[model samples]
Target: MSVKPEPVSALFAGSFALATLSAPDGPQFPALVTPDARVTDLRVALADEALTVRGLLEDWAATLPRLRALAAEDGPRRPLAEFRVHAPVEPRQVFQSGANYRQHVIDLHVAHRAPDDDRPEEERRAEAAEIMDRRAAEDLPYVFIGLPSAITGPYDDVVLPAWAEKPDWELELAAVVGRPAYRVSVEEALEYVAGYTIANDLTDRATVFRRDMPQIGTDWLRSKNAPGFTPLGPWIVPAESIADPGDLRVTLKLNGETMQDESTKDMIFNVARMVSYASRTARLLPGDLVLTGSPAGNGMHWGRLLRDGDVMEGSVTGLGTQRTRCVAEDAS
Candidate 1:
């Protein structure tokens, strides 16, 4: 039996407006606009309406014009009352990359390893010097995982869980898995990406690292995967829209002050390397989320932590920005 082609719709006025494209076969088509622009889940409308699409990222762009027209002419924008952003698909697990940025590695070395736990002060300094000498050649991507419970919506208020002592923010660019991957090479990694979104990989730095034993840096999962820890999205922009993921600007603001300001160019290990390395260890399935790691200037290293009423805003150029108000555990 032949499958029937599906019509795509944009949701508005508690109903969906059907969409149409100009050049349906072309790549990167424009979205139709009839009234306003607000999108919740690009996947649901495509599926129920029999839209001819593979994933959220691919389908959205392919039917862009039709969707845009619906947004512009159909009706006024309604408030997203109960909508929340989930991983574009249900991810098997969330993976994290560490020290992928050069500045991040350097900062970690100085803040986490320079004090030398096993040797005298003078000897430690000398060893640190040697470690610096090897930095250029020894650089490699580090990977970890974040718990599913840590995830939250883009604009949702983040409550400082009572168990956390030193909650910190790590602004990162995240890639959504599009297809099942196993033993993929760096060159073929991008093909698996559905789209990209912003991620704040919140950390509890005080309990994460041990100063006395520098070798034991921290527990990767525990530090980053605490409850209400990961805040993701404003929206997922298709990879086609991003000109260069490596060149995008990343910034973080805490209570309205800029903390981290840098470019993805500073990353020592890029996204492809992270995905390739991770897939080698285990199978990476559709919807698995990967965080590209954060830059320097997290709250922990500066002896600060998230306090009640602290607002955090983070963004990547071309992607979108997100703001979350911090509240006490009981108050939320």
Candidate 2:
């Protein structure tokens, strides 16, 4: 029996915005994709030279269709593999969710409970579940800010600072905001999203807490904002393509071994709810990133802290994959 070849679909049908290095230690340009899956280098792809991916995201609704139409027309095309891909967009503001995954938070609570308090595991789990249920009912989402300077390309090398003894990985799905949102309702939240990308929110586990100030909570700046700490994106998959952001699978492999394997369905607060919660206090502008929390099976849970020469591959269904290699910070 003969099998039929799958029909070739338009490249923009599930389109992504990508950047490529134009020269060694030089400027990057928007990558133009063709209908046949080939990429073309063209200045016309971007109207403004000063506008980075962040600016493009502001007009994503109009920009996407234009690029798609351009791709359908004749143009100089190159093989997609020939170019180096950078993070899809440079976010002006980055909002990271903490303990938003049901299983992940429960795992953390159970693992960190005091040794003397030997409550039954089942009871502890039930209590954690109750807390999540309460939080969902109360409409609360824990969000923290991250610096944009820490952003790096998906395949960039992550330099583990010498002071950081326990570098860890948290793979997450990041929503890219297209419109300015302030106090948006949950029913209208997803409409403000331009697209989605993958971010590996690398953390220094040893520096997560404040040693001097026990009253203060997590020191996110010290723990999560090192240079190149956040390895983001192979591309931005337009939100329209993702029918349900909550149903996607988030997977990570450390040194070729499966580490984190879970679905966004496990999230305590879904994307819409999280976005709505974030906008309640902050003005979410175009190109701002809202990172939904990581799922269960982080490095802390597995006791497999990142080391020099270790590689981590993270992917979200349809969003694309990011592979980052770890290297020790050069003190010289």
**Per-residue lDDT of 33 in model 2:** 50
Model 1 misses residue 110 by how many Å? 2.9
Candidate maximizing lDDT: 2
Instruction: Give the per-residue lDDT of model 1 (tens digit) for 173-250.
Output: 988776777999999998887667788998877668765786987876666776668887655565666777899888
| Cα lDDT listed for each candidate | 0.64, 0.81
* Per-prediction TM-score: 0.72, 0.90
Worst lDDT run of 10 residues, candidate 1, spans: 1-10
Clash pairs for candidate 2: none
Q: What is the lDDT of candidate 1?
A: 0.64
lDDT of 2 by residue, 211-297 (tens): 999689889999999999998876777788788899999999998899999999999889998889899999999989999999998
RMSD of each: 9.9, 5.3
- Output the worst ten-in-a-row residue range by lDDT, candidate 2: 1-10
